[model samples]
Target: MKQEPSYIEALLPILTLVGLLTMNVFFFEDTLAGSNQVALLLAATIAGIIVRRNGQAWARTMENVVSTIGSAMPAMLILLLIGSLAGTWLLSGIVPALIYYGLDIINPRVFLITAVVVSAIVSLATGSSWSTIATIGVALLGIGKAIGINEAIVAGAIISGAYFGDKISPLSDTTNLAPAMAGTDLFTHIRYMLYTTTPSFIITLLIFLVIGLSYNFSEAVVDVANVKSAIDGAFNTSPWLFLVPLILFVIIIKKVPPIPSLMIGTLLGGVCAVLFQPHMVSEIAGNVPNYAEASYIGFMQAMFGDIIIVTPDADVNELLHTSGMAGMLDTIWLILSAMVFGGIMESGGLLTRLTQPIINWADSTGSLVASTVVTCIFFNTTASDQYISIVVPGRMFRKSYQDKRLKPEVLSRTLEDSGTMTSVLIPWNTCGATQSRVLGVGTFDYLPYAFFNLISPLMSILFAYLNLKIRRYELDEIPVEERIN
Candidate 1:
């Protein structure tokens, strides 16, 4: 006989998972190296056991797990390509050139705010925060480091702006997905979101501006010249190197799929390395006499293995090494492990079981929106994927909003404010893990500093409680069937 899980049953795997992950922090210095992945797998096993005991077949649970992993395949592939792209870009001097030129033009006093604005514009234009963070965000971090700012704080600024642009951009997948899940039109959701989003973004910028101005850059000024000189000595820091990223941005804006766009970027970076940094390429190839063999060997190494460019300055050398596609394997392992846990919990209805009380408690309008935000964050933490966070909560709350005569855009906007924004804050979530690996900054390290992300959900709740711009549907606009129900 089939049995429905009790609340305790639903909570068991999650509690166990959280406890294990917490223990991992104390036990391992680098948790993501393997410990975190093991923790996820163990948690999935516990969930699988519960599902089987609840009368779901093991085969069925495995099927769901397979489907979930399949869905994450695209993300895993993109990570690999990004790793390769970073490697080749470094080899080609594109990254160094950006850092070199950026140091010359960007004032250390205003660099944090500038990073935020620059990342925002790029993310807004491309409608992809991932691409923006991987390419330009990496360079910005290097520039920030050369100027003596903490990498975590710089990463926070980059993520804040990137996510801000992603949340509002018409082309963003999450922006589109939120509306679809909540039964709202795209433009309606976006317009309604500005009421809360605009304020949060303004506050974020103001905070960064203040932090930027407070910094004393007297010492960093000396280091910047040394950094630029080291980069200039190692590779050709030509303006032409900027063309590779410009072309990548154009392809992203033109709506080419992410995988193909990343692949193209990686190849273009390789070509640029051969054309513009031939001497360095030969050096990377162990100074082989034949230029053709050296080019082939260097390009292959940049795409798949460790590549380093030693510079006179130690800080510059730190910025010049890359691990290529092989480095992304740990992140991929984490994603697959997370998906396994998510699949089991979802297939067994454990997540819904756990969230039922939250929905039930959402009687008042303010509480309803608050509940939605909490549920979305909960899902982001437990499910380890942002799309699941939006989809699950949006589906759960859509009817509740309609029943309360709230506009669907309210639900959509709340979903973005919480779901889309907070996913990158959770260490195990796909967005968080990928960004951490890409930027070489830990998720928790930047969480406190990602002001925009930290503020968005609170902003959403504040609006709902204050009845400020909380749009309600006119009685006439409510469907007759819903009114009767």
Candidate 2:
């Protein structure tokens, strides 16, 4: 029979993973792209060797890995659908319509503030930071550049607003994932999150306001008319395009499952593309002979592959491309690798052993919450995936919170505050990489200006330290009805 791993042995894999990830970041810089995935797999292999030597069956270890990855499949599916939705929305002119209209209200003096607000509204409506950034955020970036604002500041404002809306919106995958991981319902988690989220948002806006007022754009003239004209020349920009998103919001409000709701949204986008953008669709088809064949090919390309709508203006052309479902494969690969490592750590008791010291040190409510927050951030940095950050920390800390008689919503809120918001700030993280690619801004360039993201973790930590709004479980009653089974 194999023997159980010692605590030191349990920590070896995590330390090794961290060391490799650090080196990967240092050596590869922006090109550290898939290095984290390799590091995770290597670490998992190390973990597997240790566990196998400790009496754990190889079959059992594989089972745990499979099960862990299976649990994350829903999130993976959502990511894929999000890509499909983005592509179709771009092809359908829904995104351009938003950009066309959004540019109309840009007060150059308060352009940063406008970018933030516009990004927030779009993200909240779509329940997707990625989509918001790729679409309206891209447009905002162009507008900001045309108005002579620093690209980093524009990128920061866009990211901050998108994440804020993403954190609270029930339609958001992270919003749903955080509560699910922490053993709470969606609405409860969102409501509790507001206590910290609201202050952070307000502070972010005020800071942007001050920064906005100090800017002198008197000589810079943004040709809003040309932007609108370019969009009009490319696609059928109309209010009717918004019906697709409105229907999505209504479905989400009606409590439809996210997968189904997003599926409906994707189909709606595809239909809109076919109906309103026939000439564009035919161009995408490129000599398919039959109009019907061309439309089918074009729509399919937009839904599942790369599609670029080349506009007369180079800047507009940059904003008019989508990668569809195929674009999500890299993220999926990263997630799967992270899950393998997480599974091995969990099944072999490595995570529990590592967290035990933190648990022992967390004698008070504040310390416990702080520990949870730190763990989430650590995972985000080390594992390089936001979902893993939330899942691993939530799993590690759930019983600790229960023992402390803390409500699940508190744990859920902390996960989002630290884990969800900070992911985009890390250069090599999946969230960070994706956003940087979408917005054409490096993570470091936007990091300092992401006021809301910077403030959120601090607010959660501050609230915990002060015991502000910290809900404890009643002594005579069960703490949370939805505690993980």
Candidate 3:
């Protein structure tokens, strides 16, 4: 690292991060738990050291870190709340009950389409792809596999649905993050993204449906007996228990802060446990001589920490588990490290350097759209962090879009199309690894099936070249298929 550097020179730390993380993903895959996070931290440290050597106060570097984390606190809180919400929802029967009902209705022949459609409905309803995935996506993966649909296709369908929500739902972090970074607001970003997102998503759904119709799925619908029995034996699964998540949903819809909303959700789940799964509370709280204290301690621990409900059936244990706030620590740490790396790149002026060429050469609207899409995908491939992918591209291209008299929405939409959607396809990306691990499918296996992802970039390019539904820099410019690329 140099003490004094030009904008291009500042990119060295970013390159170091990219190189180290790429090596870890390809050469040392799955052997290290947080190698990616450590790589980000290491990169940030190098940047800080460089700054310090240049006579910049250490306080300045530390302040940047603090500001970065501060900006991210809301997203981090939402993630943690989602973890707790997931746990309690499982305990309260919202997740498993939905899974049970879902398994019962799905036809083996249309499993792929069903996966995509159902996940879309749920994610659209909840404004959360992660929640939809963690609860329904996991169950669908198992069901789709049993139905003989390719695991990749099934995972693809799930991802497609999840990301649809991430892109369109005003509640999603990335949905919010994109506009925030671009100096645009959330609702505007979401509304504009729909221009590209809706079309690509529809095309993806059609592809899944066509594939489903073509593929032979002869396997029986999951008996759901083992899983149901496991859940039944563990928690008192009932419709009344659904109130927990229903209330939680209401709170989220009301736009309460995530921390408070999650706290309420956890408490309600514990209350439901007391009413329905008291024995579970007792078991989780551990044995004690006193009844009330044992119940209180056990329920509290289950709410704030780890709780596992034992069933005579092994499958029940898998479903009836919660890590509460603790479960989110790893993901949170990863995001923080990623932010550090991102902050360094931003502060060091490396992110600006990375996209300068595209910004300079994108003369036509078509080339501009293509350039934005390509740059976002490039960041996903090179930066190895989706947040970086979005943040860097959004920041770099903001001026270019405005210079051309295009609305910020265009750039924001392009960011989601190329940045958010493609991140899951890269094996080294955090989204890729997490989803792959969660669904028990490798990124390679799922890449082809991720039709929306595989196809969206193409769609973006096609739209750019054809100028179909393409708005102009001037609002008065007629929307039509214009010059072809």
Candidate 4:
């Protein structure tokens, strides 16, 4: 007895969510603290009411909501593990060592471009932007800050490179997921994506390079020496500290699942902290009688609570603190709230109703690809999950491509071009929320500077309109009369 809701009924919840989120920007300095979560919940309530009125049972809606949230559990768990890893990495002198060494080697004039390239290499190797950002990206941001670069711009560069690698790397989940959804193989999708991705990346690098070369680094040189001094005085910055990250990278490359890999990395970091930097650990333990007890307390504190390593230089002190597993709680809350809103809207068929018009409007090759890109972005915004954005749009557009004689790789590449690239730009989406928390930069703060991400979808759309690099089915496959074009 379910009936389809009208466009107005379907769009009401989305409009409400958008208006609430916009208001949060003006009213709250830190929207993620609680205001955004309230907005999502309020939107969900409105969607739930409309769904019930449209004859969808509340029981069924609740079931869908649970299932949707369950899908996000792994990401939430990874966020917590990343928090522990950040804390332990700091205590072990790994992150500090990276910054301390990076200061001497990386010139401020090229730091932004270097951050991009380094982050891209790491992400391509791991095939996981989340891990890359949490690990090397954290160090790069610190290096940039120490050298007087803007933290938001540095974060944007790191994210741009990380996502560039994630989009084309064969090991990436989204890279594999896109082709699977579009009836194509992995390598074919990657090969086709490079047609658009390469141009976007080159432009991104050039922008970063120009920005990097424009910086006034005369003052940063003084700060770098002082920062290095503060770090040298605090913990042992041995070259051996790098072994932890190398091992973690090995585990990731071996295709060990993210959870176990991050867990092993976290434990390894704790052990390194105890062995290499007992003084810092002992201080964190606070008045404990023996080295053993101090190690135990310090290790526990670094995994589960906040740890601050103060230094003579106040700026270094700010850079040297970690919030452990507790820091990821707010992000987890935001993810859950977003899932609630997405679930209710999807379970009631409201999302489909909203997208149907765009799908119907596609009359040409350019319009078809453009529609797919818009749908993917729309899903990222409304569903607040990257996987959903790719999966739903891929399903919706597969038949349309077939009817138009477009090869499956065209659809698959477009999926990654837009779906995978833009997810981190939206504040409520899981990628955006997690990266923002990890990097300590707001989504909007870095949106304008995430050049690669901003340019990718446009590149895809441009290629479509220009009929560049677009593959098609064999001409002979069509009937003689149907091929009359």
Instruction: Supply candidate 1's per-residue lDDT for 482.
Output: 34
Best model number under TM-score: 2
3 or 4, greater by lDDT: 4
Per-residue lDDT of candidate 4, residues 326-411 (tens digit)? 97677678777867887788888887787678767888889999999988898788766676577657655766787789988999
Model 2 stretches with alpha carbons more than 4 Å out = 1-4, 26-33, 121-158, 165-195, 214-227, 287-289, 379-395, 398-412, 423-448, 462-485
TM-score of each: 0.69, 0.81, 0.74, 0.69
lDDT for model 1, please.
0.81
Q: Candidate 2 lDDT, tens digit per residue, 165-274?
A: 88887557678678766666666687799999999999999999998887776423344566677788989888999898888768766877667777888889889988
Which residue pairs show collisions in model 3? 285-298
> Which consecutive 10 residues in model 4 have the weakest lDDT in total?
476-485
Q: TM-score winner between 2 and 4, please give it.
A: 2
- Which lDDT values do the candidates have, in the order given? 0.81, 0.81, 0.68, 0.81
Q: Would you give me the overall lDDT of model 3?
A: 0.68
Evaluated at residue 429, the lDDT of candidate 2 is 83
Candidate 3 local lDDT, 28-72, one digit each (tens): 554136776787788878777666665666666667667666666
Please provide, for model 1 over 258-361, each residue's C-alpha lDDT reduced to its tens digit, 9 standing for 90 to 100.
Answer: 66887898899999999999999999999999999999999999998898889888656755777888877876777678778877887887866876787688
What are the runs in model 3 whose C-alpha is more than 4 Å off?
Answer: 1-4, 26-33, 49-59, 117-155, 158-199, 215-219, 253-260, 287-295, 310-319, 362-372, 383-417, 427-446, 455-485
Candidate 4, number of clashes? 0
